[model samples]
Target chain A: MRKKGLSLVTALSILSALVWLAGLAWVLQDQFFADNINRQAETLKPDTAQQQKEDSSGKTLQIAAIGDSLTRGTGDPDGKGYIGYLKEDLAKKTKKRIELTNSAIKGQTSVQLLKQIQQPQIKRQIKNADVILLTIGGNDLFRGGQALEELESKTINKTEDVYLSNLKAIYKKIRMLNKNGIIYHVGLYNPFSDMQDSKTTSSIVRKWNYDSANAAAAQPNIIYVPTFDLFELNVNDYLYSDHFHPNKQGYQLIGERTASLIHFREEDQK
Target chain B: MNKLVHNELLKLFRKKRLFVIILIIAALVPLFTYAQYQEVKTTREKLGNVDWRTQLQQEIVDTQNRLSSSRMQDDWRKYLKIRLAQQQYYLDHNINPQAPGAPTFMRVFVENSIDLLLPLLVMVVAADLVSSEASGGTIKLLLTRPVKRWRILLSKYLALILSVSFIVTASAVLSYAISGVVFGYGGWGMPLLTGFSTSGEELVTNTVHLIPQWQYILMEFGLVWFVCLVVGTLTFMLSVLLRSTAAVMGIMLAALIAGAILSNMVSSWESAKYLFMVNLSLTDYISGMATPIEGMSLGFSLIVLLVWAIGGLVVSFAVFTKKDVY
Candidate 1:
């Protein structure tokens, strides 16, 4: 038995050594002298058929949330943001499973968002979403308090013009991606409602929301959900420690509001 | 030389060291398979059986959210950024990088073990190759043979190489046979992407190409075999220099564990890249992970390990031939 085992092991080891040596040679040849022409010719065409197969048998509701930090749940200790709260509320109301793909980046402006939604995976998410949630224009407007420092209507107007066009383009892209999905563009609330320059900031945010709502209105099945009133009265109580992002209670309020809108749509469909 | 190597192999087989290594691998593979099975189960449950694309999309979003935070360490942030780009590349190419299969498990297992677990096993077989003979007073009798001292050492080295190859092969076979029970054995033909390289924080996919999972595993095992051979050679050198097997193991264990720890924080050390332990993660280059140091590539690591192995061989032969046997 010992002699037989010794020979068998030696033979096996020698064979393995040779095979691995071949693999090593292949690695050098493949990595260093890769045929660039073959690689370039192997352009990856996104498999749309498999994606449709995933969509057609979907019993669950695919909710795709894309945009800025609010959609990303920044400042919330739980990191649920408004989307998390909204998901909880929807779960309570609906029997179907809620699968959320939140592709929001914190501090993302409208321009960045336009670029983000253009990514192949993000576009696939949008295409598969039964309902789309959008919360942009915060970073474009707040600029992380830089706008508060530069409270010039001239600069604000210039920013809004660029933002409005981006918003239009984003809406066109979403609509083009999924014709049936309802878009709920969550309007921004003024975190500085109780501050000294509340009037100017509030007006600026309202006008920005108004233009975005108008852009949403132009697209079919797009509903601009109002969140301005939720924080208008107790803005300080709802604001987080940063005095910028919404606290847990504020996210819950936004979540409850969006959940109500989605409920109404479910009822309409029924 | 053939008879000498055969004699060495006989001694090695009589020790049943290879059997123990195989046993160790078999015992550990199931534990990892269970852990991996639990992870996939939980992810599927959390995502409500959504397609992999959505799951990957969610992960990308989560990484983006983490990247947006201010408190993350710079190195960690860079690693995450590179990983995010690689994951995106996988998604864009419509390839499921983590598709569950026995082959996938083997690839992941070998990639993880190449640095530490595997080298330790190789050490077990190699650390006592010469030291035990010396410490047992068998060296005196062996040296009296008409065979040249260098040939004896060369036979020992060849035997070590064969056994190192055997250990790596055992791991690959055992991991696949065991993990296949749970993950199924179908992903051998599954398409995978490789040749992803990183520059700073950017994942350079200009050279990215598709290869089947079997080829990927073969290539990774090749890298694993090379890493183990270097580690085994170093241990063999120590075995020759020391009369105590325990001392050989202690030194190697310290160096390997230190290398594992240093690879985490040595991003700033800049010069630790020359150590063979840090360079043991040669598989990472193939999978396109962020290197421990800024400039360590597969080619760079391969060359570093080769130099060290050559140095170890030279020192082993020099000391073994010249040392006075009591």
Candidate 2:
């Protein structure tokens, strides 16, 4: 009986080890080789033609916003970045249902945003958008004030060159994915206009805004919305405590300006 | 042979060490649960009247802001990117992030509990298995039996493996039972999103895998079990070589702790990936955590761990059968 019991215990131990080995094999296969099971869940029947017919009665305007923290609505205590406020304003004025998908990630540089545009989800959203809003180039130029302390003319010029080329690539990629949608690239504002070196920083920001606006001008439906003048006089009042992101009132001003631009285009289309 | 194995099992159960492990786990469950409760209260207070969609968006922004600072390390940035992707996913789907409840807490406990605490506890049992017999001079009497020395050593190893399984299962049950009292037993069916890239390169938010909470828990169990098996077998080999239980336990415990510290500190070093302790965290791969080094993968880690386990087993059997008792 004792011998029998020992053999049984040995058999059980071996079996358990085999089970563990099998589990490892299974997990390995699942982790590396398993095709996405969620793909089927994402597939919706293509209904663009049917949706357009329904939209004539009462259309739902689709807005896809991308770029950095400003687009993400950081520093706004109300949690509605400028895009959120813009959605509300556009919905109220147009009296049409508005669907907003904010794909913006905070602190994203121009290169990161360019990479983000390649994601399938972002590409799909951009394709369906009637209007695309973006806020970039702040992180590229400012880099959270690290670039300011170590400012050199050569470095600034080199960085700006890389940024502009990246911006152009981003525009080309978006246009490739979406040809008809109007792209509104919100220009940078000088948050440090009230600082001791306000004059120098202001000049650099103006040059950045001018070059960026020119970049947008080269694209067919792209328009550059300027926020420099809005924050020029009351920089302190428009900025949050961090002195980097805009306060709630500042976002409201931006939202209103962007809405006005979209409003006129909607009227032209009608 | 059966009676010898039974006697070894009896000897392990009679010790106070096993009970101490149980008591410690029982005490930890409620402490973790209360801590989770406090966390949820503060988050809800901060998010008063705001919906989960906006809250998730804010969380993404917060992680991004933290990642922007030059002071942040690359390791932390990688982790933050994963967090950012998860929050982005919740926002995209309009899924209200699950609040800190019993099921969510239990799930987290299963996912993370193995990293340090469970391994330490299991090592205690494994480290004592053979060394104590030698220190107490009981090996002489045990060897005098009709069974061969190899059979005796194998039986002890088998008992240690059994005890490791028991301890792990008990931990799971205790955590589930205790946390269930407060959080309720309703989250088994909730869909859990896994497979967010921790690679700090381009954010690939599209490759996430969705599995139910129950299935995820089962996978975590399997992974944790594999880790414990490797740890237990290795420690048992150490216990066989050392005469004093204290020395065996101390060395294994130090190795376990050091592995954790190295995995955190020099994870960038390619050589660090070959350490068995560093490779113990197989759950990281399943949950899509960033690999400690650049090129380490789930397959690479598993192969490393399996090689160590097999080598330790071979050395243990070979050495114990040949070494003279005198």
Candidate 3:
């Protein structure tokens, strides 16, 4: 009986291991394999001229969001970051298909983004995008050092003017990438709102946001959304344990605020 | 000792373990070879109908068009774009992508053996050797013979080593013979372009090289032997730990499966670099990209395997010398 029990346990263990592998494969396959399969299926679907015209309406309303971890669903306990809600909100407000493709890596900077713009993959996304969004410039100011603890200790000292100029370079690069792409620059928010440095950071952030907003004004098709207003004082409600990234509620607000920009665009288009 | 060896060989003939191991090797080698056969068949089919180079060039253009609008976050997508572009460039410039000379079948086998199934057969044979004798109580009878204890164990070890080498070589031979039946043995001499990276712009030394197909097969046979020995030594360690034949096989199999899992998810853990599974897959480095884990240099992985082999050797010797069976 003990031997039989042992064999049963071994069988159970192997089965569980296989199930784990199958589940993981199902998820990754759903992502990579499903894209190809779905695309193939879509290709086979007949595209009537009337259907093409209907799809065209959705194209101008499409929002293409690009950013660092914040835009990539980093802080949200749920998988929905600002982009997710913005997608949903615009869909409901316009009652049309408001599509979004998030092109955000965990650790990317404005300088890297400028380089990314030159890459063929990023270039195509920029060219056809009706609405473009970005939350870059953090990694450029503070380089990632593998660990958060190390990042805190190895922080660099740069004045407000230097940060503003770098932010200016990023906006300029985006304009150069797409002369006609409608743009949104989500302003930087304070994670450490309780501390005195929050004010200092907020002021610097305001200056940075001012430059972003100012630059957007210079370009005709750009919109600057102040994300700092959503979560500056509500630390307990929004920030995650790391005290840096947003919690689910904070991201909801960010998404709604960003979606509000899309809603405004949709109304103007109508 | 020669008479004992003859008797042991007779005993092995009657029992199913050795036959089962050989049967398994024969069965599995064909599985992978057949998979390769199917893929090549499909490629040949596509090649027959269209200009193969033009199809590849069109794929490159399509990938470029898709990539032109992204933030470029996915590394795999970037790698594909780079690869397709380089292939396109080679075709565009009228430079041969497949190179001029041909590699021998032997060299190709050795290079590709680590990728598929030969290591699996090694597990089957090595996991059962000593522990099966112990579990059957045949070990007591073998010890009772006129031969010295150390000499008897040493002889069994030598037998396993010889059989392992033969089995590994047999697997490669079986694959070539069987795959030749289906693939029809063409392109055995075509030069294969390897060790090129389009990740960077400079096109740093495409490193075109060639060898006969037969030599490639032999080198692959030797590489398979190394890999089997590593796996055999690991199973041998498990056999010592469990002492029961079935238990040893189970534990080693579990370890094999787990090691594969841990290596893939081991993003931050430095200690996972020491694992044999990650160490054994060094062929990826030869492809000119960094390993799955950062800081896991090829040299570090080899040293870790050497350490494990040495540790296994020391344990087997110590236990075989001192253990009592009453």
What interface RMSD, in Å and to 1 decimal, does model 1 have? 1.9
Tens-digit lDDT track of model 1 for B282-313: 98999989999998898999999999999999
Error of 2 at A80 (Å): 12
**Local error of candidate 2 at B46, Å?**
1.6
DockQ of each: 0.63, 0.13, 0.02
RMSD of each: 1.9, 8.3, 15.2
The collision pairs in model 1 are none
Writing each residue's lDDT as its tens digit, candidate 3 over A119-219 gives 44344456546779888655544343222223232242343344456566666766776777778877777665676555555564566567667876876
Residue B149 lDDT in candidate 1: 98
Cα-based lDDT at residue B255, candidate 3:
66
lDDT tens digits by residue: candidate 2, A159-246: 8898999999999999988888899999999998888878878888898899999999998999999999999998889899999999
Ranking by TM-score: 1, 2, 3
What is candidate 1's lDDT per residue for A92-169, written digit by digit as tens?
Answer: 777776778888888899999999988988888898889999999998888843679999999999999999999999
lDDT of 3 at A238: 86
Per-residue alpha-carbon lDDT of candidate 3 for residues B138-163, written as tens digits (9 for 90 to 100): 78888787777767656555545555
lDDT values, one for every candidate: 0.90, 0.77, 0.57
Given candidate 1, what's the lDDT at residue B44?
Answer: 91
DockQ for candidate 1, C-alpha atoms: 0.63
